[model samples]
Structure formats: structure tokens, C-alpha cells
Target: METTFKDFYDTLIENLECYAGEYESFIDYGPKLFKVLCDLLNSDVDKSLRLVISAAIGYYVTPVDVIPEQTYGPYGYIDDIYLSSHVLKMVADVHGYGFIAKISSPDIEEIIIECEVKSLEILSDEEIESILAYIGL
Candidate 1:
């Protein structure tokens, strides 16, 4: 059988719980971001945004990412979290935080904003660019 998004989400969450290290707090939002992507996929958003959201989800589930949790543990989720917030920011730009808040949590916007800032603090622009390029996102 083909692996569904739920299967990926469950596996990612399990890995995150075991590997979340110094960035544990930031990594904690990994599940929430995955949930937001799932919610967006089910929402009435346009096709392009859904594609980008899907890419972000793919990046999160892949073990061979820029910072693989398989290698770096919880620290590996930094890039995944960053990409999620980045994609969510793009959606919010189009539909507004209120729109996302309806599908996700009331504090999701805040969480995304914080994750973006914190991720930047850890990874440089070059590193973030490489991560994006790694997945062709």
C-alpha cells in the first residue's frame, strides 16, 4: 500500500519526539505545522499554494534533508520547521492569519512567526537556501 500523509505525519512525530535536542521547543511545533499543511490541503485554497504546502510536507518527512533527524536528531527538524513556517507565511500573505487560524489554532500564526525568526537565528541565509534547493522547493 502507498504511504499516506497521515503515515508520514505519524512517523515524523515519533522521530521528532525521540530526536528533538537543543531545538526541542522549536521542534515541538513540527506536528502543528504538519497539521496546518493537512488542513490547508483539505481547504479551498488554490492549487499552487497546495503544491507548495505539499513540498514542505515532503521535506519534513524525508530523512535525507539538509539536517536529517536521522543524523542530527531533534536538531534535524530545524529546517523542516522553518520551511513549514515559510510556506504558511506565504499562505497567510494571501489569505490572512485569520483564515489560517480558522483551520489551525488561534496561536498558529504566532508559532509560525516565532519559528521563522528562531530558525533564522540558527541557520544562515545560505543554509536556508541550500535546504530549499535540496528539495527543489
Candidate 2:
């Protein structure tokens, strides 16, 4: 059976809540980042942005990522969160944070900002680039 986004979201949240890792704060935005990605994918965005959004969402669900949740548990979500933030930042840069905030929840802009900052602390620029390459972004 195909795994729905909601199902993945539930598992992501459960893992994060039960996690006891050093990157807890950075990974906390996994749900929020996922929510925003789902919202964007459902929205009437242009094709290029939609592709990027879809890639990020695909990365979230796929077990063969930079850090697989199957292996690292919730901590594996760190790369997923960073990729989501990176995609969100791209959308924000093009349409502005207000536009994303409008499409998603109003408070999401702040959460996106926090996720970006926290993700950087855990993953380096080279690591982020490697993740992007891994996902073919």
C-alpha cells in the first residue's frame, strides 16, 4: 500500500517526541517543515517550485536518505528537516515569507526561520550540499 503523507507525518512526530538525541532542537521542526511541504505540494504553485517541493516531500518519505530514520530513529529526520527548510527558503526568496505564510499557517514563517538556523548548527554547508545532491536537487 502507498504510504500517505499523514501517515508519514504521524510517524515523524512520534519518533521526534520519543527521541533522546543531541539534535532534538534542530529536528523538532520536522513536523512543521513537513506540514509546510505538504501544503505547498497541494497548492497551485508553478511547475519548477512544485518539482522542488515534491523532491523535498519525496525525501521525507523515502527510507534511503542521507540519514535513514530506520537506522537513526528520529535523529535521521535532521537532514529531512534541513532539506525542507532549504526548499522553503527558496520559495520564500521567490515569493517572500509572507506568501508562504499566507499559503501555510501564519506562524510558520517563524518556525521556518528557526529551523534554518538550527539545521545549520547541526549540518555543515558541504553536508547540506551533499544532501541536495543525494536527492538530485
Candidate 3:
């Protein structure tokens, strides 16, 4: 089945839960994902759109964040949304509409939404500010 942006986001967050225990795994997986994202950016897409997607991916992978995962649980998934939407938008802009037509399962979407909502509730203002600073916002 085709995965939706939400599904991908949840997977990224769930994988991140291993940041402490499976640091090596995260490190290993990151390069491969980064390559795929890079390929998407280098496709026949417009340069401006590609640049935006590249920037979003860079921001998503960076340890710095607008919402730190340590404080926000899965709401950190927002970073994934930011990245994926930019990619999808670029694809549509260059390839045409109906690009990225595959939607992820509803279950995955719910998990991502739940995690984001819970994280938002648990994270403090100070922590959020720190995260934003880390992300250079």
C-alpha cells in the first residue's frame, strides 16, 4: 500500500524513539533517507521548489528543532510534515497535480496526530523556545 505523509512522519518519530538506544541505527538509516530526499530535489523540478524542499529536509534532519522531541514526544512529527509537504508541493509544481496521490493508512495518520497533540500538551514554553532557537527560528 502507498504510504501517506502522516505515515512517514509517524515512522520517523517512532524510529527516533531509538535515539538513545539505537543511535547507530538512526545514523545508518539517516543517510539513505537523505539520499532519497536529495534525489527528489534533483529531479526535473524547478530550482526554487527544489531549494525549498532541500532546506526543509535539512531542517528536518538537523538535531536542532522548532519542537524538540525530548520535550514534545511525537509532535516533533511536524518537522516531517514540513518536509513532506514541501516535497509534494515541488513534485506537483514540476510534474503536475495528482503527484503523490497515494495516501497512507488512517491508523498511521491517527498515531501521528495523537503523538503531535500529546507532545504539544506536554512541552513547556521554555522548552519550545529553546527548540525554536536550536532550529534558528
Question: Listing every candidate in turn, what is its Cα RMSD in Å to the true structure after a full C-alpha superposition?
Answer: 3.0, 3.0, 10.2
Locate the minimum summed-lDDT window of 10 residues in model 2. 3-12
Full candidate order by TM-score, most accurate first? 1, 2, 3
Clash pairs for candidate 3: 4-104
Higher-scoring candidate on TM-score, 1 or 2? 1
Once fitted onto the true fold, the runs of candidate 1 whose alpha carbons sit more than 4 angstroms away are 1-6, 18-20
**Shift in Å, residue 69, candidate 2:** 1.5
How many residue pairs clash in each candidate at the backbone level?
A: 2, 0, 1
Q: How high is each candidate's TM-score?
A: 0.87, 0.85, 0.44
C-alpha lDDT of residue 26 in model 1: 79
Compose the digit string of candidate 2's lDDT tens values, residues 2-51: 97565777877776887667877668779878888888877766668988
**Model 1 Cα lDDT, one tens digit per residue, 1-137:** 99756576677677766653677777888888988898899998778798888898888778698888778777778898899998999999999999899998899888999999999999988989998887676
| Residue 53's lDDT in candidate 2 | 90
Tens-digit lDDT track of model 3 for 30-109: 32334445555545556656666566576666665665555655445444443344344445556544332323222333
